[model samples]
Structure formats: C-alpha cells, structure tokens
Target: MKLLHVHSLPLKDVIIDLAALFKVDYTRNCGEYSVKIPSTWGTGSIKGINFQGGLGLLIYDCNFNTDVEIHFTVNDIHPLKFLYCLQGKISHHFENHTDEHPLSNYQNIIVASKGNDGHVLKFHKNEQTEIYSLEINRKLFKSKMACELGKAKPNLQEIFNDDLGDKSFYYNGLYSLNLAEIFEEMKNTNFDHLIGKIFSESQSFRMLTQQLIQFDDDSNEDADRIILRKAEVSAILEAVEIFKAELDMLGSISSIANRVGLSGNKFQNGFKTLYGKTANEYIQFLKLSLAKDLLVNTHDSIQEIKYKIGFNSHSYFSQLFKKMYGVNPSIYRQNYLENKKMNRSQKDYK
Candidate 1:
C-alpha cells in the first residue's frame, strides 16, 4: 500500500482512516483504546490495547512515539516488524521468540523463533513523533536477500548485525530515526527520486536479511561438525520432523539417538547444537504446542487432553502449561472463549 498522506489531520482521524484502509476495527474511549486488525492482508488477527495508540511505531516531527500492546493471535509466524510509533507506547508479546540482548534505544531486536513469547516494549509519547511502520515480509525479504548474497538461504541474524553494526539500537528507536530521516528527505525530493531511494534501501535490507540467514546456517553447520563427526544438518532436520510426527514415542534419548545413527551423547549434544534444544525438550515443546491448540480449538477436558498428549498426570500438565504460557490451560481456554464472545458483541454493536 502506498503511504497515506497524514500531514494535517487530527491523530484520531488519521488512525481511523488508516484502520479502514487496513480493514482494522478500532475504538477510542478515554485515553485508552483497542484495535483489532488482521496481521496480514488476508489472514491472522492481532488484538491489543491502544493505551495511547496500538503497538507500532510512529514518527512525527522527527521524534518517535510508540505506546501500544499487540497480542499476536494468528498468522504472525515471522519475527521482524517495522513500526512507526505515532503517539504512545507499544509492548510486543512474542509466542516462542526471544532477543539475544536487550535492544538499545536506537537498535532493532531480532526475533528468534525458538525464543519465548511475551517480548514487549513501551514507547513513551512524543509530540514530535511522526512514525511510519513497515512489517518486513520475511519470505520476500529472504528471497531477495538470497539473490543479493548469491545463496539459496542466508543467515538474517548476521546480515542485520553487520548492517547495523555498533550502531545497533532498539528496533523501534533506530527505525524511528531512519524512517523520519527518509520521510523528511522524501518531502524535499522529487517523487520518483524518493521512490528510488526507498526501493534501493529496501533491496539493501533484503540482501542483509539473506546474509544473516546464511551466517546462521553456517554457524549451525560448524557446531554440528563438532558434535556429530560429520555434519548432516539436512538429516537432523528430517529427524526432527519425524520426531514431531511421533512425539509420544520420543520418551527416550536412545530412541532419538538410534534414529540419527549417533550414540546417545553425540545425538544429545548434536541435536542441541543444531536445533538449540535437547531431544526431550523438543518433545515437550511439541506437546505444549499441541496442548495450546487443543485448548483453543477443542472442547476436550483438561484431563482428557493431558492423557492424549501423553501427560499422565493433570497437575503436572497444568504446571508445565502455566510455566510456558503464563496461564493454566483452563484459564487460557476461558480467556480465548471470552475474547471471542467480546469480539462478537463488539461486532453486534457495530
């Protein structure tokens, strides 16, 4: 979508217009607000409190302001987001993603898929905040970056590290400055030239993403060689898929080791090196994910669900579920159902 001209309108009007264009539903009550938007054009739902404004970056008058909390419910499978915080703070809660380090005020946080959820940020208000958001399309970015790097799959982590370098700062603040500078420059430049600059930078970013992916792949290969005598990243990945398919049978480390033709110690260490988790840990993760799905989509009783997922005891399942999700399974299910009801009621109001 072409960036909408938002120079002179009231903030609320601008927000509403943008929401409409994006097919998002929003309500502003007091200083607190709420927004429900599709994570992508066609699918996924992101619901959150727009305490000041919803989660995303905004740039106005060279300053940055982002104060919104977005709970990514569906279709947000990737880890990177480019947001412009317009007026308030924003906290992002991740599902299974973690940051390598805390983001500096002007750096970006690389989202790791294996990381935990609940990653968040709070952007303070700034009158001069005039921000724009760009949610990087990972597949597209990866493809384009790979072309630039001359690799089929590149390491995005290293690419971002190299590009941002010591200048790394929190993702929001860094992008705030970059975007503001670009937008300001755009205002003074010819339209064609402005578009050209954006496209060039975008292409550069794509290349950077690819490089990082390649770096990560190489890192894995190196680590794998140290533990497995011979590195077979592809085979390990295949084994992981197989293990996922028969998660219930993965109770023993020996079974996993035998499948990969390695001794128990080698398999354990190699799996951790390649995938960042032990065999049992990975199995538990699969089980947790399955439990989450069941909690959300089915009416199965907790005990029944636990037994089905190979958890013999209800209390143990509940504890593990809470540890991972921050809420018990029953509560999680209840909350989801309540939200669904609330959404329906809101729709009826409209």
Candidate 2:
C-alpha cells in the first residue's frame, strides 16, 4: 500500500497537490480542478470543484494498478465529507482512530472530523471505483444556508449548524432514491462551461439537501437500513415476473418490493437501473400492454378490460390509455380492427 499525504487546504490546491504527486499537470477552469490519471498508474480521472458558501464536490473515477492511500493531513480542520461509492470499493479512517470504515458500491458515508484531525481514504488496486465526495467547509456553509438548520433532526442540526467545526460527526448507510437520480443526471448531462458550472452547483446543493434528508431517514430508529446489492439482480427479475403475472391485481410498490425481499427504494433503484423504469411505472406499463393486447384480440368491453387489468375506474383507464397511445381505448381498438381488416383485404386481393 502506497501512502501519499496531502497537506493542503481548499479543494483546488488539494487536487494540485495530488496531481503534483502524479507528476502531471491539472487544468483549472473557473472554479473547477481536473486531472487525468497517468497510464503508468492505471486509468481514469479526478475532478474537484468548490462552490460558494464553502460547498464543494470531488469526483474520483479510477482503476489503479496498486493499492493507494491518500491521507489528508492538513494542520487546519478538514471539510465535512459526504462520500458516495458508485462503483468499486474504498475505505475511510480518521487520523486519530485505528478503526477503519469500508464504503462499498451504492453506499454513502458522512464524516466530519473535529479541529485539525485528518481523514484517510484508501483505494484498492485494480478496482474500478467511482466515489463522489461532497465536501462542506462548515464554518462558511453555516452562514450561507438558505433554510433553517434548527428544523433538522437533532444530530443533523448539530452537524450543519456548527459554524466553527467544533463537533465531529459520522454516519454511513443507504442513500435515498432522489440522490441516485441526481447522481445519474450529474453524470449524464452535457452543457457548455458556464451552464455546466451553474448546473453542477445547483445539483451540488440539491445533492446536499437529498443527503441531509437521507441522513434523517437513515437515523429514524424504526426505519430499515438496507443497501441495494448486485446479487439482488435475481430479486429484480423475480419482481418483473411477478408484475407480469399479477398485473390484473398488482399490489403497491411497498408490497411488491417486500415480496421480493427488498425495500421500496432498493426495488425502485434496481428496477430503474436494469429496466429503465420504476416498479410502479413498470406495473402500469404491463397493465396498459395487457389492455392493448386484449383490446385487439378479445371481445371484452372497455369497462371489462379495465377491471381485468386492475384499473379501478373506467374513465381513468380510458384517459390514461389515450394519453399514452394518442387515442381512447375504444378508438384504439376500432383503429386496430380497421387496419387489420384493410391488411386482410389487400392480402386476399394480392
């Protein structure tokens, strides 16, 4: 394990220090700092940007050849970090503590060290890891917060309300569905530099808000804390089959997810990742598809079709069917039959 110490403050300098160790130069655009990995070390890139009110984001997407540990050993206080692992795995250790915390894919950890204590992040060798860190300089952020920090839950309030970074905080658990969507958008969106910065800063704030809400939800003693797992791919498949077979009487997302040994958030995320739709959305799609098939192939009335496909109201079903297909269910059926007859006549004449 190679240890590279970073003795720097402010995000851009830290990236500069890191790139210095890499013996490469990084680009500084507006407030963003970015550096690409050298071929010798492996592949990928590291990017960091600091926004107003002391909020910042650091993204590390790397596949390293050897295990590397980057130690943030600044004499001053370190920023509160919201660490999210989207790909492989990484670990965290506070400067003064011997115990280490592992952060795997689809997991997040919120940590803030008191005073001058540092943070150490370890990246595994040959592991393709994508980790995003939301770094908050508490002293500056406390004054810039738009909402009331007091309204937050006790622990959260203490962490965010601390302007001087006197208190230390650490929490690790499953992130929220909203955050997952935001992360996807941040990664996939393309825009000009000005618009990109604006977009990123806005998304960064939203990420902070979602993380705070996630922390609150995670802290609720009654809430179940379950991270989505890659092994649960089978569970998602089972869910799809269940939805297909039970479209006529499909239950709520909660019921369906519970039936598949996952939480609603996990089910929604996994379903979105694999199938590009939420569980509820997929269920609706199945119902509509069955309705369409039965409309053309069977003699069931619209009301009957509605009931057969688990829609509670005939008018709602018709409205939704028209909204999706650009015509009401009755018209859709008539059009299908008309087209079918015309094709049959043409074939017979031919």
Candidate 3:
C-alpha cells in the first residue's frame, strides 16, 4: 500500500498535487475538476465542481490497482463534510479516533471541527467505489445563510451549535433512496457548458439541504443494524459487480451465493437488505437500463439487443422495457433520435 501525507493545502490544490504524485492526467475548468487516473492506479476518472461561498462537491468512482492511504492535516479551520458512498468502501479515521469509520454503499458521514482537524482515508484495491462528498466552510456557511435568509435559522444554529459549539464533530448514518436517485440522475445527464454547470451547482445545494435535514433528524438513530458480517457485505457487493459484468451469461443467484460463501437464502435476503431490492429485480433493472442505453445510443435493433442481453422473446423484453421506462424500445429510440436532432438544430441556430 502507498501512503501520502498532505499538510495544510486547499482541497483543490491537494487534489491537483495528488494527481501528479499518482501520475494521473488532471484537468480543471471554470471551477470543475477532473482527474483521469491510469489503469495501473485505478481505471476511472473522478470529476466534480467546487464553488465559491465555501462549498466543495466531489465524486469518486474508481477501482484501484492497489490499496492506497492518504492522510490530511489541516492547519486552519475544519470544514464540514457530508460524504456518501454509493458503491464501494472507504475508511476515515479522524484525529483522536481509535477506530476507523468505514463508509460502505448507502452510508454517509458528516464531519466538522473548530480546531485544526485532519483524517486518514483508505481506498481498497480492486473494489470500484462510487462516493459523493460535499464540504462546507462553517463560518462562510453561516454567513451565507444569514445573508440569504436574513438570519441563521434555528436548524442552522443547531448544526453549528451542536457539541458545545465546537466545530469538530462527526455523525454517521444512511441516506434515503430519494437522495441516491437524485445523484444517479445527475450522473446520467448529458448537458454541458454553462447550462450543465448551473444545473450541477443548483442540484449540489439541493442535495446539501436534503442531506442536512437527514443529518439533523432524530429518527436516524434507530436505523436497523446491518445483519451481514463485513466480509459478507464485501462479498455480496463484489458479486453485484460480477452480475453486472456478465449479464449475458445470466449468473444464477445460487452460483453467486456459492462464490461468496453464503447460502442461497442468506444471500438473497442479505442482498435485498443492503441494496433495497431483490437480486433478480436489481439485475433486471440493470438489464433494462442497458437496453435503453443501447436503444438510444447504438444502432442495434430491438430484437438484436434483446438477444444480446439474454432475452429469448422480443415480446417479453419489450413488455419489461415498457414497464420500466414507460415506453417500448422502438418508440424510446425514435424519441431519443428526434430529441438529438432537435438539440443539434437549436445549437446550430444559436
């Protein structure tokens, strides 16, 4: 494992410097940042935007060739961070903490501190993790609230006041499915330029508000415990990745369970509990989503796509596709083409 220590740098500079140290191609434009790490390190790109008024938004979706640990030491104020992991695992251990905080899929953590604060984060090898993080400067956030709403509202006051007004605090919990869908939609959108930036910035704040509501809610304390062991959870998530990769072969649940060293019943129940859907349903959802993408983006015929994705009957595939997307495959393809052409014409006219 490779370890790096960063001392007292702004987050943007930290990322840029890290990219160079890791030998990755990095880009920044109009406040948005992107880093394309090589396959030897992790074959994916991390991209997001950082805005003024003390807000920083980032998304990390990658699988690394080796586990890496990065430790941060802040010489100034500690920023409040809301970090949600969607697909893999990342561990954070802040100063004065004995044990690491493991954030897996669907889990979130909030961190703030008054004194100089720092944390150590570890990314696992060969596991593709998708994480979205929002960081806010505490004083700037409060000032922004006062300027926009005329005062620091009660809830805002409470957040900044919690832990005896100490800025350094930690809250860990799970986020709702609605929040996950919003991120998914944002990731799937094709818009770019000023329009994309504005939309992303707006949605980032919207997500922040929603996250803060959940962060302060008292009901989250009673959330159910995850029944599966940590090893089981890791195994199941790996199985999910395999399921998506080999959809054409249609791997059976029993096979997946066997591979993961879990019994079939435990596998099914545990998977549903972790992912909020049955294994079959999730796989079908993936299939339909891929089918839609092929329909819109590829020249493959509906029948060909159906056959390619392991569906024998065109009618059966069409029925499921319509149920999921509210349109049959052919119509969906037609509308996608029309929209593309119209967009082109509008851009040309402009």
Candidate 4:
C-alpha cells in the first residue's frame, strides 16, 4: 500500500471541489460564511483562515463570525470528520436537531460516523478565533496508520470526539512529524509504495495497537473467572442478543444476572467464563462485527451502520470501532472495496 499525496489548495478551491464531488452548492466568502454540504465521497470541509504551517499539519486561525451550520442528510451512514478549535467555541446538532455544548479555548470536536441522516453542526462565534483543520480520507487512517496507534475498537462518533481529543506525545506534535514524513514519501513514491511504508512504519499506529492489546489483556483477567461458568455464559450471551434486538432497552450485568436468577458477581463471573470476555467487551464485539458486515455488504452510510449496530451515537460507534479495529469504519469500508477490487483483478489475471 502507498500513501497518496493530497495536493493542498486554497480554501475556496477545496470547497469548490468538495461541492462538485457532493453535487451541492456551498456558499462561503472572505467574510460571513455559509455552506450547504451534502454527503458525498469522503467529503470534509473546514471554514477558517490559514495560520502557521509546519511539515505535516496545517494550522489555521478562524473565528465563527456567525453560526456555522452543516446539514448532513443521507440515511444509515456516518461521515468521518474532524474539527479542532484552537481558540474559540462551537456546538453540534444531530439529526437536524440542536444540542448545546459549550466549548472554550483549546477545545476540539472530532466526529466519526458509521452512518446517519439529517445531522447538522452549528458553530457560533463570540470573538476572534483560530482553528486548525486536518482532513484526510478515513481509509488512510485505517489502512496505513490506525493499527499502529493503540486505539481500541471505538464507537465511530466517540473516536472523532473523544479519541482524537486524547492527544499523546505520539499523536500530537509527533503526528505532524509523521504526516510530514508520509507526505515526503508520497511526493517521492507511488501510491502503492507510500501505502506500504505507511502500513509498515507508522509508529503512532503501532503504539496504539500495542496499547489496545494490553488493555484487552488487563481486562481479560477479570473476565477469566466468569468464563468458567457455563450458565453465566449462556445468560450473558442471551442478554447481549436481547440488548441487540431491543434498541430501546439496556441492562447492567447485575440486571442481567437478576433476570437469570443469579447474583451480580456470579453472573459477571459466569459471563466472563463462558464468553472469555466481559459483558461490555462482548457487546462491543457484537456491534463491531455487525458493523463490519454492514460496511462490507451494504452501501449504507456510516451513520446508518452505527444505528443498525445499536449505537445511538455515531461518535461512540467510531470510537469503539477504532479501539477494536484500530481504524475508523469508513476507512475500513474503503479498504474493503479496494481489496475487493484488487482481488477481482487478480482473479481475472489468473
């Protein structure tokens, strides 16, 4: 796999190209900005002015002069998008509905979607603000980078809003450095060669994978005793399916245990014993596995996939998917398509 070089253009050009790709009209200017972005491709847009630049990442200075409203209406899919506010405030609206979230200085918003419809974001401006934007295909992160990053199978939405916010030494400044290196490689190499290096040599991604495995190991100890109980295993599995089927209902381990006529601790232990995983882990696995199936077989949006897998929040779904799979779901889907194409081509040649 090769890392492809994405040519940077002026903000207007970027917006125009994105609009063309989405086949929608987006209005913006040197002043008061507005845009109607329809979901298309791996579409992403940033409404802000440019700031200091380094090697890999580009920082910007932006103020939300008016409310920034983004309307996303494609059913059953979530788009992968990231936004960082280095200096100002913003809010988010989901399903074309509004939610008030106060974001102060040095705050950021990262959104990863399995799929959703009629979602919107409105960023209100109070004072002069500076924002930094990094937009890449979610597939890039999934294929060559995410596995090395020690990310857990994250809920997609959570990965964008939470995981991305939890910056470490490797993902912060070092991430910029890595991006620079990747870009250099892209400039000097073909897509295949670049992707190969990215997949193989991304230290950030490798570290993430290591951390996730370790977390799983630590969690496994608590799960061991529970795994030994056959009855508990049966109950927990039943609970998981029930939760899956009844999206409106949820239960704790104790609740599940009570339903099975067992103590909470006993049920928990039995669940671990039978499943070789905790109840939470089992649920996450079930969701992620289901998400994988949807991404592979259906052209559903990321938001739709998130909901289908019983994740009420797209952000949470993205986070869980990343924590488990190390890459966002959108990226995984793209890779699936690319691999499928490659496989088909190989068969034809054969």
Candidate 5:
C-alpha cells in the first residue's frame, strides 16, 4: 500500500497536499478547490468546498491504479468528520488503531480522533468510489452555532461541545439517503460564479444539517446501537432469504438473528436499515404479499390461505391484509378477478 501523509487543516491546503502527492496540478475558483488524478496515478478528480463557521466538504470521485492510504494529520485538534460512501468502497482506520471501518454504498459514519491522533483512509486499486468527508472544526462550529448547541440533545451536546477533541468517538450507521440528491445537484450543477458559490454554500449548510441530524439519531437509537460493518451486510441480505423460505416456521427474532450470525439488536437494526422494516414486519409484509398472490391465482379458501401463510386467526389475517392493501383478502381477490375478466372481455371483442 502506498502511503502519503497530509499535513494540513483547511480544504485548500488538503488539495495542495494531494496535488503534490499525485504529481498533478490543482485548481481554485471562488474558494472551491479541485485536484484531478493524472493518468499515471488514477482517474477522475477530488473536489472540496469550505463554507463559513468551520464546515467543509471533500469529495473523492475517482479510481486509482494502486492501493493508496492517506494519513490526515494536524498539529492541533483534528476536525470531526462524517464520512459518506455514496458509491463504491473505501476503508478508514485511526492512526493509533488497526480496527478498520469499511464504508460503502449509502452508509455514513462519524469519527473524531482524540486530540491530534489523526485519520487514515485507504482506497483500493481500480475501484471507483465517490466518498464525501464532511469535516467540522468543532471549536469554530460551536461558537458559530452557540445558540443551536445549547438546545441540542445531551448526547449531541457532548459531541458538538467537545471542541478540544478530548474524546475518541466513532459511530456508524446506515441510510444517509437525504444527501444523495444534494450530491447529485452539486456534481451536475455549475459552480463557476458568485451565484454558483452562493448555491454551493447553501447546499453545504444543508448537508451539514442532515449529517448532524443523522448522527444525533444514530447515536441515540435505542434498538440497535451495534456498529454494523460492510462485511456483515451479507448476513443481513442472507436473512432476507431466510425470511422468504421459512415464513411459516420463522422463529423468534433472537433465534433468527442468531441463525444469520447477528445479534438480535444488529439483526433488527440491519434489517430495518436495508429493507425499511423490522424482521417481524418484513415477515408480515411477505406473508401478506404471498397471500395476495395465492388469493388471486389459486382456489384456496381464506382459512386454508391463512394456515398456509402461518397465520392462526382468519380475522387477524384479514385485518393485516386490509391494513396493508386497504381491503379484505376476499374483496381484493374479487377485484382482481373483475379486472381480469374485464380485460379479457375487451380483448375478445377486439
């Protein structure tokens, strides 16, 4: 692995450091910074924007020819960073620790190295990825958002209030879907003039808002506080197949979680993160969907269908079906049949 140490604070200095390391030139226009990867080193580009109140963004949209590890260091307090992997893969590990956090997909993680410890990012060879690092100079940001910080939750207060980087904090969670649109807009939109600068500056604050909100929510999520990593995402995906094949005999959440090599907490959290439902809710959704299919295509009675779907009570089954589809199972089936009959009659007449 090729390693380069970055000795800088603001986004501009970081871009200059990257330019020197890659043996390429960088540019600056209206305070936005950019450095393109030379063909010899990689492809695509790295861009950055520094907004007021100590908020900044660094974007990597490139593929390298070799594995590159960059160490971000500073003499004083290192900025707290919210890392977002919008696409592809990358790894992050503290300078003092070997426990690597692989970030990919739409996942986001927050890391604050203890005073002056610094951060290290590893990008794999030939894998193009777009990663966003939202850096917060806590001392400056705290002063800028003093009124807001006073009203923050106790947990958030602790984070934003840690201006000195006294604590080594790391929190990871899934789903930062809100920033996707902003990233697309920023990438595609022009940022050449003062109006463009204003647009980007506003967007930076919006991005910061989303990151802070998500970090706050993830920090206090009472259900599954376990840090789900990229390697374990496969287990979450496997759990879906188990849900599909064993709907009838599905066990307790703990047992099912154990079967999938996840703790119950992580199981629930990962399922919800990936599929937008708890395991039980996902199971219920699948059951109702299957019951609808059988109702439309088979001669099974409601009682038989309910039993086939592992539901013991017909009324409860009907209730769930109605809650999901806005009608009783019989009515839904009848409506489908009526629609099918109408379509067939029309076809025959034609």
Candidate 6:
C-alpha cells in the first residue's frame, strides 16, 4: 500500500488519513488515538498521543502481509524524532540517497533534523514490527525547557545547535530495556482521564529525558572515521540473531566469526562498535537479562534459571549477576516479589 503527501498536515489529521487509507477502525478523543488496521495490512494495532503544540508519541505492534510505503513531507521548522524498534525492521529512504537506512530489532535512532524533501518509510511483509516513536519540535523544546543545556546531566547542546533542515545529525544504537519498558507502560493501558493525561505527559517527558541521556552515552561525533561495511554489519547482525537463538550454546568467537566470514578480530571489533559491547559481553548480557526475567516472572528455582541460561557454576552466575545488578539472584527475586506485593496492596488501599 502507498501513503503519499502526508507531510504539511497536522499529525492528528495525518494519522487519521493513514487509517482511512488502510480501512482501519480508528478512534480519537482528546489527544489520544488508536487505529486497528486490517490483518492483511497489519495485525495488532497502532496507538498514539498527540500532545499540545509539537510533542507526540506513537507505538506500533504489527506484522504486515505485504510491503507498505509511506512518503511524507515535513514542516519548515524541522522536527526531531526518537525511534526505538524493539522488533522487526524498517527501511527509510531519503531523497538524496540511492540507499535506504534500515532499522532493525533493538535499534534506536535519533533523527535530529528532518530533511528538506519528503522521505520514505517502508515496512516489509511478515515482519513483526514493534516500534516506539517520539517526535519533538526543536523550537518548542528550546523555548520551554526550564534549564540550560550546559548544566544538564546529558549535554544535548550539539543537537540544539544543529541548523533546522539538516539531517546530518543522527545517532543509532541498541535500544536499552529502560526505554523499552517506558514505552511498553504507555501502551498497556488507556490513559484517557484527567489524571491519566497528567501521567501520560509526565511519562512522555521522562521518555524524552531518557532519550537524551542515552544519546549522550551512544553518540559518535566522528562517525565518518569509524564506519562498518554494510556486509560486515549485516553479518554481525546475523551473528547476533544466532546468539539470541542459542543463548545457552555460547558459541566460540572463531566459530561465529567463521560462520559470518570474518576474522575473529574484525568480528569482535565491529560487534563492539555497533553494539557497544564485545560479542562475548553481549551474549552474557542477554543470558543474564533473560535469567533475571525468568527469576521475576516464573516460579523457577535459582539453580534451574542458572542452568536454563547455560551457567554451570552457581558461584560464577551469582558473581556476574551481583557485579551487574548489585544484588544476588535470590535476593533480587525476593525484592521483586515483595515490591510487587506492596504495589498491589497500595492499589487495593486506594
């Protein structure tokens, strides 16, 4: 399906038009909107909130049956975007480039400037795309921000200073769990009441704050100096998928490198550059994170969880868990259970 000329319209109208084009069930009240498109177009739904002025949030949980393309223009005042793709891939095409920028699972991208002409958004068939998008008006941000950028914990002065319409300033990396959870919370309920509105705006601002802080940690000012070949990056991503599928296997560096047709040194270096962690470190992180989830969400023993993640040594597992989270696995699980109980109690009292 093709959606054209969506630029120049207000965001609300734009989304409404999109729903109409897809023949989806669309609803809007106050500033909150939800669209339920046909399963052929996509499954699940697309939800959004368009706040006053120029702040907006959109969440997509979908799998398209065929490729879909969106080409839209932007306003004269450039809008910045924070996009986190928790799953699947999206391809973006700019007017000036023959190539398209692909955003895959766990990837976060910041488009600091909207380009001059229209841009394209392409979604592929059978890809389960889960994405969170936040749009900010740069001019509004500068005017409304209460503090000076120079004194902020995360310096975003460089982003603030980029001339409007310059798309050169972009940052991309793995989407942290912190960001994923914040957006997930926004989607788990309907924030339509007065108190809900206040909470929604607060969460939106919090998401923005976290994005800036993450941007500070992940930004590369000299991207030209350290660029990975497309094939290399693609191979590394394939390796990542392999790791995800076989978290318990803990494949050797050379094996993964050989599978991807790269020297061990090159694979390690490129993995570190793209993911901000060595290949081994990334695998360990995934295992530990999955273990933590199982601990909190399942009624499994610590030993079982350890073995599930392929850790044979209990001492080694506890040591790594404590080093990363500052708590033992059992104690961490207990704390999580207690906190959950307390939250339930508080809600009952209310």
Over 169-199, each residue of candidate 2 has an lDDT whose tens digit, in order, gives: 7788766656777889999998878999999
Task: Encode model 6's per-residue lDDT on 62-175: one tens digit a residue.
Answer: 788877776656656445677777778997665455567778976777765345655567888788898777877666666666467556654487676444665455667765
Worst 10 residues of 6 by lDDT: 222-231
Return the top candidate by TM-score: 2
Alpha carbon lDDT of each predicted model: 0.47, 0.85, 0.75, 0.47, 0.84, 0.73
TM of each candidate vs. truth: 0.36, 0.77, 0.59, 0.32, 0.68, 0.59
Q: Model 5: per-residue lDDT, tens digit, 159-259?
A: 77888878788887764445666777877898558898899878888887876666665665545545454556788888888889888888787887888
The parts of candidate 6 lying over 4 Å away from their true place are 1-4, 23-25, 150-155, 219-350
lDDT of the structure predicted as candidate 1:
0.47
What TM-score does candidate 1 get on C-alpha atoms? 0.36
Error of 6 at 278 (Å): 20
Displacement of the residue 45 alpha carbon in candidate 5, Å: 1.1
Q: What is candidate 3's CA lDDT for residue 179? A: 69
Q: Which scores greater on TM-score, model 3 or model 4?
A: 3
- Give the clashing pairs for model 2: none
Model 1 stretches with alpha carbons more than 4 Å out: 1-226
The regions of model 2 sitting more than 4 angstroms off are: 163-167, 190-193, 221-238, 247-255, 262-288, 291-342
Error of 6 at 176 (Å): 1.8
Q: Candidate 3: which pairs clash?
A: 112-167, 112-168, 113-167, 113-168, 114-168
Per-residue lDDT of 129-206 in model 4, one digit per residue for the tens?
444444333333444445543464453323333322232111111111123333344335543444543532343243
The residue-by-residue lDDT of candidate 1 on 163-243, one tens digit each, is 222222232222322233444453455434446445434433443343233334335543242334222444567678877
Residue 344 of model 3: what lDDT? 100
